[model samples]
Target chain A: MTAAALSLSKIVAGHDGHVSISDVTLAVPAGARVAVIGANGAGKSTLLKTIAGELPPLGGQMRRCATCARMGYLPQSATVDTRFPVSVYEFVAMGVWNHVGLFRRLGPAVRQRIDAALDRTGLAALARRPIGALSGGQLQRARFARLMLQDAALLLLDEPFAGVDRPTREALMALIDGWHAEGRTCLVVLHDLDLVRQRFEWCLSVDDGHAQLTPTAELLALRPTADGAAAARHAFLRDALRA
Target chain B: MSWLLDPFDFAFMRGALAACVALSLGAAPVGVFMLLRRMSLMGDAISHAILPGAALGYLAAGLSLGAMTLGGVAAGVLVALAAGLVARRSALREDASLAAFYLISLAIGVLLVSLKSRNIDLLHVLFGSVLSLDRDALLLIAGIATASLFGLAALYRPLVIECADPDYLRQAGGPGALVHLGFLLLAVLNLVAGFHALGTLMAVGIMVLPAASARLLCERLDSMLALAVGNALAGSIGGLLLSYHLDVPAGPAVVLSLGLIYVVVLAFTALRPRPILTSEVTA
Candidate 1:
């Protein structure tokens, strides 16, 4: 049996006095592939942010394994500064920073790992080139290479496929599928339902401030909500509160 | 060559040149990180905020570089701490707090300078004199620059990663926050070190322009830092020579040289071939 990677008990998180997401309880068993889906501002990103430790939960106890350093997070495309002057190789090498710390040199094994990561992501050919010099599809590939090097037990991706071309997208999904095959857990925040089911094994549908463990089949069975997600989460929260 | 050759003939000119070279070398890489962290304005704020300390140093031990520099570094660090606190505590924005820092420091500096020195001496304080520099200043600047270089060489990756992506850094459970504040402290200390040659206003350019120009040309952080340090050294030397030959002020001259370097970088990058991929971002 796989260990649990993340467990949040009755967590409440928000900013500026208003709770964005509250009273959410979820446990992501290690190696489980889960997708979070909802309309905009269903607290999907907020929840992800809190879980990623970018922001602390406003309420509740959140606990994790002490060796949880093997966790990877890819923020939304907008939050990243895509204009830094780094080569594809240099950028991907950064995935080892947690282990590197300050004032340490990368050993040959680590270099080999970085090389393997880039190759795994289908970015080996692009290693020598400038990161800024890559096309949208190519850049995403480079970022994915970094993710691979993290050797993370769990992967959290926020819109990884955004702006990527078609062939490259397939390649990326294949790479993720490969990770899933290796028994690593992944929680991907994706926009496409077709890709979600085709690639993911579990679904976490969030509406209003609440998310549920609906089987992937059920979310696929129930169509995307009407009146958008912000309202949907509210209505869903109201119903859950009454129940 | 004569411009370089003639400067060594005079001890003060030699001292100014050596000090400027050293200060620029260290400040260049520090500036690169400063630009990456979006604290270019903060660099300026710290430089100016150190004025009262420099003034206090002069008041205590007379116009000795040792006393004044220590005082200045202390004051600059205090202002940075204050700015950090104010931005966190008050509704005022970071830039606004920096502005408050600038005003208060400037006022205190003016009051101190008025209490002792004449107006031209204060002018020399704001804008350094080629004639007043000595071998002691040169050695001090050299020591500071060398130490900064060694520190930067050791910490470049962590620093670059801190600026490039803080989210992953936090998830990775590294000391991302402390490292970030350390980077800010580096900026303050570097600015205080460069305060004499570059002055407060022009010091930031000496720190920022070379890095900015290098950014246009390079695709890697290490290479960019290397190029920036080279650019700063070359630019300051060029400024010193031109100012010496043309009889212009040295501080403005050094900055003008960096400005001209940026213009050249802009033009060259426009004409140069970029990497084949579409978007280039650092990690």
Candidate 2:
């Protein structure tokens, strides 16, 4: 049996005293590409935030196995203040904070790594450009570059492909595939059913106040894509209005 | 040359110049961070919050620099923490809570000052006596400036990450809250130091105006920091000279100099050609 990278026992999560997802118990297997799916306001982010340790879970316990000690979290693009005065290279170089931290110079090896990450993300030419000047797709690519440089064991991505161009999305997906090949665990919050269906083996469905972890193939097969897509769209509109 | 050199001839003028220059060194960078965090107005609120502490210190120790500085730092930090707590726990947003607290702080501070001290002493606390800088005030300002620079250096990486993407910092187990609290403490320290020369009303002026001006012209953080500090240094010297020659109050003159620089920067950026708006392009 594969070792569990992350384990959550009857976890209850929320923000600012309001509970969003309750009794979410799951043991995410090492190397599993888990897709987190839900309607708007269904606490998808709340769950991810809890696992990433950004928000403290209101109840229950979470344990990260020894191998998955380091975690990388990519928040939604809009949540980042891209308008802050920083170059793309400088922003991406921050990923080495784990190693270089404060006071240590970004030595040659780390500089090379940052350069390689930026190059892979196709941001080499725009390295010196202010982050604020990047288009949505470019900024998303910059974020991915930073995440790559983070060299984390577990990656939690929130809507990573949202507002990104198809080509950029494909490139970023390739990066994730590379990490998956290296046996890194990824919990991705995604809205694209096709991508989730094609790429992910497991799904953590976050519905109104509840969370269920299931096999993606089984879940999609039981409902099929068309009906599931319609229901999701309906729920999105309903939740939008309620919010 | 003599007109410029004349202000430095007096020991008090020399001391005041040293104080202003040192205050700008620390305050400008703090201002740049504050502006980037979108907490520019929050500085104003915090400066007002320092008032009651300074007042209480004056009431207790009667114009002792150490007492006022200690009291100001304590009061400033308490209000900051209280406001943060209220914002986190209550429905009101951070800015709203800070606004509410600062208004109350300002009123209490004025009331406290009027209780024991006469109006003349109150004026000294409110406007500051920059022209009469003594040894202890000079040492305090210099010490704060040196400490602030080192603090900012130590906190640079976490601070930048916190400002740009706070969630990522928290997720990575970086000390985001501690960095924020530390930054606020640095800001308060700089404000307290500045109040010795510019008064509470104008202390934040040194912090914000040059930073706001720099933001218009600079596209990089390092450049912004350099430019803001440069603007502040110019403002300090120019304002001191203006006060000496024009016979105006030095504190307001210095702040007004920084403000003038801001207006000039605003005008320069406004007149410069901007990228053509997408809406203006005809297909």
Measured with C-alpha atoms, the lDDT of residue B267 in candidate 1 is 98
Residue runs of model 2 more than 4 Å from their true location after superposition? A14-23, A207-243, B275-283
lDDT of 2 by residue, B1-283 (tens): 9998987998878988998889889899999999999888788888888999998998999888888899999999998888889988999999999899889988998899999989977777778788888888898999999999999999998999889877767766788889999999999999898888888888899999999999999989999999999999999889999999999999999999999999999999999998652223421
Candidate 1 TM-score over all chains jointly: 0.87
| DockQ of predictions, in order shown | 0.43, 0.43
**Worst-scoring 10-residue span by lDDT in model 2 chain B:** B274-283
Residue-level error in angstroms, candidate 2, position B163: 1.0
In model 2, the Cα lDDT at residue B110 comes to 88
Q: Which sections of candidate 1 miss by over 4 Å?
A: A1-3, A65-69, A217-243, B1-3, B84-97, B267-283
Chain B TM-score, candidates in order: 0.90, 0.95
Clashes of 2: 0
